[model samples]
Target chain A: MRAYLLARLGWAVPIVIAILIINFLIIHLVPGDPIQALVGDFPTPPGYAEQIRKEYGLDQPLLTQLWLYLVNLAGGNLGFSFANRQPVLPLILDRARFTLLLMLPALTCAAVLGVVLALAAAPRAGSLYDSSVTAISLIGFSVPIFWLGQILIIAFAIKLRWLPAQGMISLRETLTGWAAVADVLWHLVLPGFSVTIYYIAVVARVARASVLDALSQDFVLTAKAKGLSGRYVLWRHVLPNALIPVATVIGYNFGYSLTGAILVETVFAWPGIGNLFIASIGNRDYPVLQGIFLLTAVAVVLANVVTDMLYAVLDPRVRGSYGKNA
Target chain B: MAVQPGNILEIDALSVTYRVRGKTVRAMNAASLTVRDGEAVGLVGESGSGKSTLARVSLGLIPRKIARIESGRILIAGRDATRFSETEWESLRGDPVAMVFQDPLTYLNPVMRVGPQIAESVRRHTPELPLDQRVEELLELVKLPSVVTRAYPHELSGGMRQRALLAVALGCRPRLLIADEPTTALDVTTQAEILALLKDLRRRLGMAMLLISHDLGIVASACERIYVMYAGHTIEWGGAGAVFQTPAHPYTVGLLRAAHAVRNAEGRFATIAGDPPNLAELPPGCPFVPRCSHALAECSRDMPERFDARSGDPHSVRCWLYEKPGLGFDRAGTG
Candidate 1:
């Protein structure tokens, strides 16, 4: 297992480097002038753009700029945001915590609810409950995240007056300790649920199909024949086997959720990395954009590696195959 | 083998139908058979002949929504199993009766260690016993090494996996073990080994067994009584020796001939002329009438009832030739 992890890390290094290079090239290639976006609606003094370009090292050739960027990146400096005039790494790190706080619970909820709903629907597939779940999941999957977010805010925050709608917490009132935590949670619900709904649908459908497949397998029949109750058989035999594909789907969906968080955070005005990303894009803050992209790439790669390792742990066949390779 | 009072399993006119796309397909038509205590009964048939269906029904493992019991009764250990609820079936399974499926790989949970899989059965039936000890004992009973308990299903050879499955089947110390094509997926050598292990287990444990298979040779070697099925009907049944020596039904005769042809490495093996009947569109009379060479005109018009093939023996055949005395003599001469 250690050897497998080490080998995976060895492969990850080159892939991360490749991703960094591509991300830098794509940002540079895009039609945008960070200096001009920064100086928007201002009468530029003669040579002002040139002075700003020279100040940020954007005056250098493309290759020279990429090389310097790599050198600065390797030296643990994410450079300065052209718009915010702050170090990009610290800015991302501060906002990233909020994104994690929101996303982790949302993803976990989606996964658990999806599997539970799927399990309930699988045995009675084609029945009213199954069809209803299928229909609901389809709607959840098709509905846009921003639209869903607005609808949730209207329903819960405006009309019902049950929960707070915008931002991370109540700006009007002072809160501390558990009250502060509760306030944050109250605000999280709408955006968190909105972002999670689509994933819940993806996971639920996968869980349903996988569980149904597992139910049809001969081992489930054997488990049933062993005098185990249907519930026991489902819990022990069906769920574990069915969870493999579901876990893989969740891992891949992590990257998707990051992108989705941007749209949802914009709608809800949640102070997370997603909201920062949108602000950076509008400002043409290349450093911050580059930082967010790199972090997201690293997160996606780490998720995939963890998922592969988890597969090995969950399935002995996968473990054995790895052992043979080792 | 006489009709005994203390039969471990009894299916009385049990008919099962599968609902496929709004059409009811009769999978088993009033099939009835028994396995007395400590007796080994082999049910032999071609594919789709309802052999496996019979096995599944005996254990009440058939899917409820898809397959329905049209009419009849299933009595396990003289307890009417026809109306057994899910909880009742759960209690009955792995204790009074247990099953070993055809494909060993499929029967064993791939992700689970062999020990835990067997231990699960032990825990279900005998929760008082220490799990590790019971698992070790069951593994020993199947002649598998102690270390084998820690291995996954995929780690073991086909024979070892089958033995592990047997250990699981015996975990509850069931009164009857239903082996549905237990050796079908094994190689020639492993098949013999599994059969030998099953025979030994049956002897030592004194557990009645219902061994379902398509191989005549396998059934002949392992079982005392043999039931021959064709298309969804129990066409002929008797002591294994008697059934092999004098197959009364043409389908049974064809099976035996095919078995012999394979044994002798003949250039061309004998085969039943047509496909098994489609249950959805079954003819009014006999299911085997289309393929039976000795089928008479009335055979296609009326279903044949089970009749004694010998005066004093318990052997029986479901054929028009066997039912009419004069016709039986003439058919016997032709053979």
Candidate 2:
């Protein structure tokens, strides 16, 4: 297991470097100048653009610029954002925490809720309750996240007045400690649920199909013939086999949830990396964009590694093969 | 333990129907059979002969929504098992009756270790015993090595896995064991070994066994009495020796012929001429009328009921030719 983990980490280094190179190239390849975007529509002095370009080392050749960026990245310097004029790494770090706070709960909620609903519906497949769950999940899967966020805002925030309308917290409150935490949670409901709806639908459908398949297996019949209660058979024999694929789906979705959070964050005006992503795109802030892309790539790779390890733990067949290879 | 002195399993006129695509198919039709204490009864049939269905029904493992008992009685250990609820069935399953399935790989839970799977049965029947000791005891009873307990189903070979399954079936100290093609998935040498092991275990444990298989040779070797099924009906049944020697029913004759013809050096084999009748659209008369060479006009006109094939012998056959009215058919001269 240790050797396997070390081998995976070894592969991750080159992949991350490849991602860094691609991200740098793509951001530079776009047909607009960051300097021009920064200067805006105001007429400037003749040497002003050249002076700014030289100051940021943008006057160097593309390869030279790439080398400089790589050297700075290796030293843990994410460079400075042209839009905010601050270190890109620290700014992303601040925003990333908020993004994680929003995403972690939503992801967990989706997984738990989806599995429970699927389990309830799977046994009586094609019945009224199962059909109802299927229809609701279909709607959740098909409806756009932005539109769903708006609908939620209109219903709970506008008509029902059950939750706060926007932002991470109430700006007017000077609250701290538990009061502050409660206020933040209160504000999170709409965006968090909206972002989670699609994932919930995806996960629930997968769980239902897999669990149904598992229940039909001969092993389940054997478990039943062994005098196990229906509940015991389901939890012990059915769930572990059914949940293997579900776990992989959940792992892949962890990285995918970030892209989904972008729209929800914009709609709710949440102060997270998704919001920062959009603002940086508009300003042509290459450093911040590269930093965010790099972070996402690293997170996705790590999630896949963790998922593989989980597979080994959950299935003895996989563990046996892994042991042989290691 | 000495063998208990009554029928361990009894099925009387048991008929099972399955609803498939809005049509009800009789999977097992009024199949009556029994296994006495410390006896081995073999059920032999082709793929759709309802042998497995009878085994499942006796164990109360049939899927309720898809299949239903149209009219039947199942008595296990003198208890009326026909009206058993799910909970009642659960209580009866591991203790009074247990089953070993056809395919060991499919029957054993892939994610579980062989040891814990057997231990689960032990826990169900005798929860007071320490689990590790009970598991070891069961494993040893099946002649599996102690280390096999820690191995998963995939880690073991087909023969070893089948042995592990037998260990599980024996864990509950069941009075009756239903082995549904227990050695079918094994190779030739392994099949012989398993058959030997089964006979040895039946003697040691003093449990009645209902062994279901398609192979006449396998059933002949392992069981004292044999029941031959054809298209959801018990066409013939008797002492294994008598049935194999006489084979009064045309279907049983064909099966015996096919079993023997395989040994011909020319690689030629006799086969039953046509397919078994579809359960949903069965003929009004006998199910085997379409495929039987000796089928009479009366055979296609009405179903033949069971009749004694030989005087003073328990051997019975469901053929109109064997019906008593002094037909002068000369049954002993035919086959």
Quick one: best DockQ, which candidate? 1
In Å, residue A260's CA in model 1 sits off its true spot by 2.7
TM-score of each: 0.96, 0.95
Task: Name the runs in model 1 displaced over 4 angstroms.
Answer: A324-326, B1-4, B262-267, B326-335
- Model 2 residue runs over 4 Å out of place are A324-326, B1-5, B262-267, B325-335
Ten-residue stretch with the least lDDT total in model 1 chain B: B326-335
Query: Candidate 1: deviation at residue B271, Å?
Result: 2.7
lDDT of 1 by residue, A1-326 (tens): 77778877788888889999999999988897888897787898989889978888888998998899899999999988777767988888988888888888999999999999999999889999999999999999999888888888899999999988899989999999999999998888888888678889999999999999999999998898899999989999999999999989998877655555888888988888889999988888889999998888888888889888888888878778758555
Best-fitting candidate, scored by TM-score: 1
Per-residue accuracy of model 2 over B1-335 as CA lDDT, tens digit each: 22234988888878899999999898888788989988999999999889999989887889887999999788888888898998889988877888999999999999998888998898888999999998988888889999998899998999999999999889888888999999899999999999999999999999989999999999999999999998888889999988988787888877888877743445667677788789998777789988876778899887666888773458988888887566445433332
Candidate 2 true-interface contact recovery: 0.77
The deviation in Å at residue A214 for candidate 2 is 0.6
lDDT of 2 by residue, A1-326 (tens): 67667777888889999999998998888988989998888999999998999999999999999999999999999999999889999999999888888999988999989998988899889899999999999999999999999999999999999998899888886999999999999998899889788889988989999999999999987888888898898888898988888889899989665555799899999989899999999999999999999889888888888888888788888777757556
What TM-score does the A-chain of candidate 1 achieve? 0.96
lDDT (CA) for every model shown?
Answer: 0.87, 0.88
